[model samples]
Target chain A: MTGALAAAAGGGCHIFSGCGFPAPGLQDFIWTPFFTIGQFQFTKPMLLAILSALVVIGFFWAAFRKPKLIPGRTQSLGEMAILAVRDQILRPSLGRKGDSYLPFLVSLFFFIYIMNVMELIPVFQFPVTSRIGFVWPMVFTVYFLYLYLGFMHQGAWGYLRNMIPAGVPWPIYIILVPVELLRFFIFQPFTLGVRLFGNMFAGHLLLTIFTLATWYLLSLSVGLLYAVGSFALAIFVFVLETLVTLLQAFIFTTLTATYIASSVEPAH
Target chain B: MSVRDRSGRDTSVEAESRALGLNIGWTVFSYLLSGMAAYGLIGWLIGRAVRVEILFPVGMLVGLAISLGFVIWRFGKRGITREETSR
Candidate 1:
């Protein structure tokens, strides 16, 4: 999508020109594989996902490589980032007792945040999460962890029993039980992935549309005015995407912690 | 046990409430979705068997009502308990 839009803009696909508007669509998300190994096709989003992981690891390693009584600038930044996730996201759900899960949550938060932030960076304008494939594994891991923890702590039968709200009449349980089961086993994990994917996908598509429109509207005539408006809107959408990226990551990590907390402690 | 601002006012309560709000919002949405989907599918299956097409939409309405009733009972119970505690 990025390269295609750039080409169209450079090629002068203006409104005055007979050439139709090169509207961005799902094709924008479909990239030619950089290389192929057997049936596996390596693409830009895959590279971005790997690079996101490395960026997270490399930053933390540089920050905390040498233990220091007095922290350096990098360490301070590292501490600030981790503490933000811990204080704002993890603790609100899990409290002090769940401190052991801090490293996992921190990694998840930064990995997701950086992957999303990639959409804003030059030459890597695609959000990896917009590809639902990347999101599901993360969602499934959290789902598995919480379910495993639930069974481990509460016993399998007890865990199932705990999911049902107590004091509800026996007959109502027929309906209520299925609803609760669907909510926990299916809907929770499904929504977790869908929420992140939908936000990134829609945000990227919107930015693409406005940006392509800006280029397509550019002309010597009154079309230039519309082009300028489109350009401004493109900039606005770009700025909004930055906040959306972070907010989505926060929501994902917080929900992960919430699920874990629920598993460790039964529903009230 | 609670977080505090620079002025030393505890902010954990506010944070917890915000978290609760987020969870509740999602919970409500999921309940509505699950109810409609579950009952709607059942209705579709039964309607297909009986050759009555109206049951699909009817099923969805029934599901929505059941979910709404359950949610009200569930949270309304908590609300009543809180009121009693304050008294």
Candidate 2:
């Protein structure tokens, strides 16, 4: 709500205050910290990220606290959530052997979904995952876990052997080695975090633009039609945001599973 | 084993997972991008030292080619398929 667009449209049409369409930029996304302790500062997105994790953890705790063989309503719901993730996400990449990681995968899927949905949520309309600090932890966790799994399952030499593809010829190693190293070490995690960040950042910005435009365009006379149009676009963007929130979460979790799968065995 | 997508239609989990794996196309793209940036910079510096401006683009092209080949070798050669897994 503190966006440049909102700031520009503040109160009403301002002739002296220089009223025009203000483009949303990094300034709009920066949140002033609520408090600071020494060099550490606590910000809103950080709170939201923590809250997202707590909500996922709390929900699962409450849902599965009292397990029933016959399955109560809460138990059934919890079971369904887990089963959906396992079937759609884990099973796809890791297959049946991946059952051991069901808990981790379920937590990841829901946490990301919750954080993403926050952008649409009232009062807390910000996708915390839009920040690199929030996304990189997830990426690095996946990066380290998969790397550990890779080395563990394949050993040092075997892992390296499997990583650099066979039959590329010794002459091509000059080029391929750097490419492969950069791909794995740098871009793999970089893309993982950036893809999530980019989607959420863009989504939040567009939603702000449309919503702010709708507010700014509101008038009793000629501007009425433009206000309506902007409002309609805002609604359309909200619907699209719903799909993006879910899709981004699914993609992130699926990629994590695939990384685990690739690391644990010979990747073709 | 059938899995439902967002639409609730039944889909083979094997085929679905394979399809989903292709979502990693972004990883390939970023790999190519980083490859070009890092190696191209190195090539440019070398070119500057050697007085050949053309080496920069050549280095970028080589980096792109290497990343492309890596992608082809990594993702293109094989994937989890129902027919093959059934065997």
Scored against the true structure, residue A123 in model 1 reaches a CA lDDT of 86
Candidate with top DockQ is 1
Leading candidate by lDDT: 1
True contacts kept of 2: 0.21
Q: In TM-score terms, which candidate is top? A: 1
Across A1-268, the per-residue lDDT of candidate 1 in tens digits comes to: 3455655856867786888887777778887899999999999999999999999999999999995879999999999999888788777777777788999999999999999999999888889999999999999999999999999988898888877677788899887776778888999889889999999999999999998888888888998999999999999999999999999998899888878887887655
Q: Go through the candidates in order and give each one's C-alpha lDDT.
A: 0.84, 0.78
Interface RMSD of 1: 6.4
Model 2 misplaced stretches (Cα beyond 4 Å): A5-10, A13-18, B1-24, B69-87
Error of 2 at A238 (Å): 0.4
User: Across residues A199-252, which tens digit of lDDT does each residue of candidate 2 receive?
Assistant: 999998899888877766666766678879989999999999999999999888
> Model 2 residue B60 lDDT?
92
Worst 10 residues of 1 chain A by lDDT: A1-10
